[model samples]
Target chain A: MTDRISNKKNITLSIIAIIVMLAAIYVLDIVIKPTSSWSNLMTCLEKGTIYALVAVSMNLLNGFTGLFSLGQAGFMLIGAYAYAIFAIAPEDRATVYQYYEGGGLIHFSLPHMLQDMMGGADAFGGTIGYYLGIILLMIFAGLITAVIAFLIGIPVLRLKSDYLAIATLGFAEIIRSFFQWEGLGPVTNGSNVLRKFASYDSSIFPVLVAGICVAFIVLLINSSYGRAFKSIRDDEIAAEAMGVNLFKHKELSFVISSFFAGVGGALLAMFQNNINAAPFTSNMTYEILLIVVIGGIGSITGSIIGAYLFVCCSEWWLRGLDAGEFLGIEADFMSPGFRKVVFAVVIMCIVLFYSRGIMGTNEFSWSGLFNFFKTLPKRIAAVPGKIKAKFSNKKHKKHTENVKEAQ
Target chain B: MEFIAKWLPYILAGISVGGQFALIAIGYTMVYGILRLINFAHGDMFMIAGLVMVYMATVLPLWVSVILVLIITVVLGCTIERVAYRPLRSAPRMSIMISAIGVSYFLQNMALYITGGLTRTYPTIDWLQKNITIMGASTKMVTIITPVLTIVLVIALVFLIKRTKIGMAMRAVSRDFDTSALMGIDINRVIAVTFIIGSFLAAVGSILYFSNYTGIMPTSGSMPGLKAFVAAVFGGIGSIPGAVVGAFVIGICENIIKGLGLTTFSDAFTFVLLIVILMVKPTGLFGEKNIDKV
Candidate 1:
């Protein structure tokens, strides 16, 4: 009875916490427009949110289910294209597919069509339409990707680590080439850029979506099914022995992960406002995987943090580095790619030094924060004394050496 | 007769390309066989090998540049193995894989920075450029040379792997890392040797590969590299001869598909082939049966 009561309290606390966070974010979202200068930061944050969602999706498969799939980019590509096609306005198809002889087969937008069928045609052309369209498109994208994952998973998931990695990598390549195929030009526009989609006016939209998705993933991770996924990660044979249904759980995890990856990809298409097969290459998958590694693989909070850091590093912090200026200094030969060189070096260092990444499968919680605050004053007080002691010890090293020699 | 006439040149092109792929796939299989790590940087090494040829041929004779390319790539391969992979030997598989990927990105970006994203024309050799008619079909001389060279190298490699003491050590190491170490096999030396051999083969492959291709870019190695890795898996990962066979099959299949007026589907078709092969035989054509211990 007491345990049940505590569980009830925990649930109520979590609900209240989530509501407060959401409310605060909603107000903040209203406050910020897509203004200049700081708007770029907001853009970076928005991009980071989508990346975090993708990273969490990867973490669900790689970190939880022990499936090293490089197919995230492929699924993302599908999702982005699906969203681009489904959400593209009826009138814009001509211009979007200008170079191609035949425009896409999709003449009417899905949401608008649905709206007309519902007899709410007047309510369909405004921001509400955009919202409904994007949500529906993203859902369709997720379902499509999940279905693809299901089919691909049947054959590819049975392969072991590096083999699986190679297979998925091939899958991504196949997806790229398929989209680039000329025969599919009527529908896919044959590698031509697809543009003019409904996008977020403010960064808060993706922030809310990604935040809720990640929280949901975290809840899933903490559940019994998640434990089964973890068990599979620990050892597949043992998981099977324990009646975990290895293939079923792996497929489920793969489908779920691909669903979010697709959603994230849809968000990516919206953010870019132009969809092309060129951008959805293995490199994109590699970058997201790098984010997952930089974040603790099994930790959702780490993925969120890592996504922010990666976005900030590449978009904001590394910009000046790329411009040939280093901390108030300028160089003549500073090429555009110096920032990436430095960034790659830093990533290598992190991979070497903190292989477990920033989180190490640990999550950030209120209790942890409370404990940190409790120790804050003591740590602050000890810093000066510790520095002084270090200085003194270095200065008195000769006497200490003499003492050691005497001993 | 008309179908044969039309398809014969493509077949020749396929065999030629197939040869280079076999060489590259051999590198993948050998490294994977020993290290049990997917050396993602291997493709970049192949790219760098091509780049070295481009840079050197502009300044030196073709033969000297070819020799220098081989040397530079060998040194590079060894250095990468020692620096990027050696320390992570005992770390988790994922960490090593990430390190390999980091090395790959670093190399590609550095090339990008140096070349300024320019696509450098691969220096052509006079003799290798000759168009020769074989069985009423004309094809580039390099195309005919590629498969022959691949076979010769494979034979020599098989000899090195089977008839030599170092090859014995290599086999032992590949069989069991700890047991070989306990038996006094120098793990580091064996790994370095594997990398050297792999890099050497990739260098030669790059030379033959770029001969047929138009130009070299930072991204050039990625496509061929991806295809070669796929070939390695399709042949069965860790099996050398299997890699060679897989490469030829992929090369020929893609070429034939390209010939079918579905040129765009060729790349996608390779993966489709991979999926089909994997479904039919998950371990690949020659991959050893997996044995698990409780």
Candidate 2:
């Protein structure tokens, strides 16, 4: 009975914390205008939310399932393209697809179409319809990518380890080239940027979407299927021996992880307000993979923390390093690409020395936090005594050495 | 005659580029044979070789710059092995691969910072730049010289690997890493020698490659690097002759696709071929089959 009550209390506390975080984001979004120096935090929050989703999805496959697939960028490309292609305002099609002669295919806009059915954009009904349409559109994007992943998985999933990584990487490159092919110019815009798509006016859209997706992922990870996935990661043959359908579980994880990655891509496209297939290279996949590694591969919360830290550090904190005036210390060697160089070196150090990363396959818990805080004062109070003991021990060792020499 | 004349340039370019790729692929195959690593930074190393040659040629004589480039590249490759890869010898394979990716990222960023994102013009070697005619298809002398140079190097490499004590050590290490160590082979020394040979060949490949191109960018190495890796895999990774053959095939096919006006698919074609090969024969044409143990 006490355990049940404690569990209820924990749930309530978590809900409260989430509400508080959301409220804080809303307040910050209203207070800090885009032009302010502090706006970097907002940009970080937006990009970080998107990256968090992608990183966690990747963690699902690479960490939980032990499938080292490197096709996240390709899935993201499909998602971004699907979202952008379908969400473009019908009137803005000519302007966005200037090379395609009014986008020979995909003429309808999901939001605009839904808005029209609900008495146009000025009414409350239309406003609700627009958001609803966008929600459906994002899901549609994820579905499209999921379907493609299903097809790709059939042939590619049989390969082991590094071969799978390389094969998926190859598929990503193939998808990139296909998207850039001129014959598919009308639909994909032939390597040109797709823009003027429907996007969120407020940052809450991403935070909410990412929060829900992460919650679902967390729930999945706690389920029996997640345990099966973990078993496979630990030992595939052993997993098979224990009656876990290895291929089925692997495929399920791949599809679901890819589904979330696709949504993340759509969100990314929304955040950027434009999309291009060019930047969706193997490098992007590597960046996300690095994020997962930094976050402690098997921990979802770690991925979230790592994603935010990575985005904020690279996009905001490291900006000063690039501009040559970080912390009021200016140096001639600090140039445009110096920040990335420094960032890469730091990542190398992390990979080499701190391989367990920030969380080390552990999840965050409220009880753990409370216990840490409770012990903080006691730990701090013991610091000076420990230091004195160390110093006296060194002195005693020196005196003993002198006495021995005299003897 | 018209058909032959029309197709000659593409085939010639293919053979030349194939030779260049062959050099790079040999590096990849040899390293993978011993270490079971993809060595993602090998491509970046090739790019650095090009950049080093460009900068050195401006201040030093051409021959001196070439030699210096080779030495610098060897040093860089060995240093990377020592610093980035050696410490993680006991770690999982994935961790080492991630470290390699990290190294690649570092190298690319370093190049970007040094070049200030500018495309450097490749210094033209007079001998290489001279036009030569082969069967009514005129091309740079480098086109002809690349294959000859590549064959000579491969012969020497094969001879060394088949005859020398270090080569035997390498073969033993690749065959069984722990067992070779138990047999008194200096594992670190063998690995370092592999990097030396790989980097030296890559430097040579860079010289021949950049001689054909008018400019070199920070990203110039990635495409060729990937294609060469694909070649290595296609020829059955860890097999030298297989890598060479695979490089030639992919090079010819890619150029042929370009010749056919499907220019965009030229890069994609290599991957398509890779997937097909991987699906049809996971062990590749010359690769020994690996059995998973419980």
What digit string (tens of lDDT, one per residue) describes model 2 on residues B1-294?
999999999999999999999999999999999999989899999999999998999999999998999999999999999999999998999899999888988888899988889999999999998998989999999999988999899999999999999999999999999999999999999999999999999999999999999899888887788889999999999989899999989888888999999999998899888889989998788999988777
Question: In candidate 1, what are the lDDT values of residues A1-407, reduced to their tens digit?
Answer: 11123556667877898789667667666766767555556668788989999999999999988899999999999889888887766778789878766566768777655555555545534556657767888899989998998988888888878778988998888888888887888788888888886666666688878877888888888899899999999988888999999889999999999999999999999889999999788888888988988998888888889998999998988788778897898987677878887888888888878888999998876556566777789889999999999999987997889899999
Tens-digit lDDT track of model 2 for A1-407: 11223787889999999999999999999999999999999999999999999999999999999999999999999999989898998888888888887564779999889988997989999988888889999999999999999988988888888878888888888889998898998888888999999888888889999999999999999999999999999999999999999889999999999999999999999999999999898889989998988998899989999999999999999998999999999998999999989999999999999999999999988877777677889889999999999999999999999999999
For each predicted model, how many residue pairs clash, with residues at least 3 apart or on different chains?
A: 0, 0
Q: Which residue pairs clash in candidate 1?
A: none
lDDT of 1 by residue, B142-243 (tens): 998898999899999999999999999999999999999999999999999999999999999999999888789987888888888878888888888899
Task: Give each candidate's fraction of reference contacts reproduced.
Answer: 0.68, 0.71
Q: How far off is model 1, as Cα RMSD?
A: 4.2
Task: Report the Cα lDDT for residue B274, model 1.
Answer: 79
> Model 2: runs farther than 4 Å from truth?
A1-5, A378-407
**Candidate 2 local Cα displacement, residue B26, angstroms:** 1.1
Error of 2 at A110 (Å): 0.6
TM-score of each: 0.92, 0.96
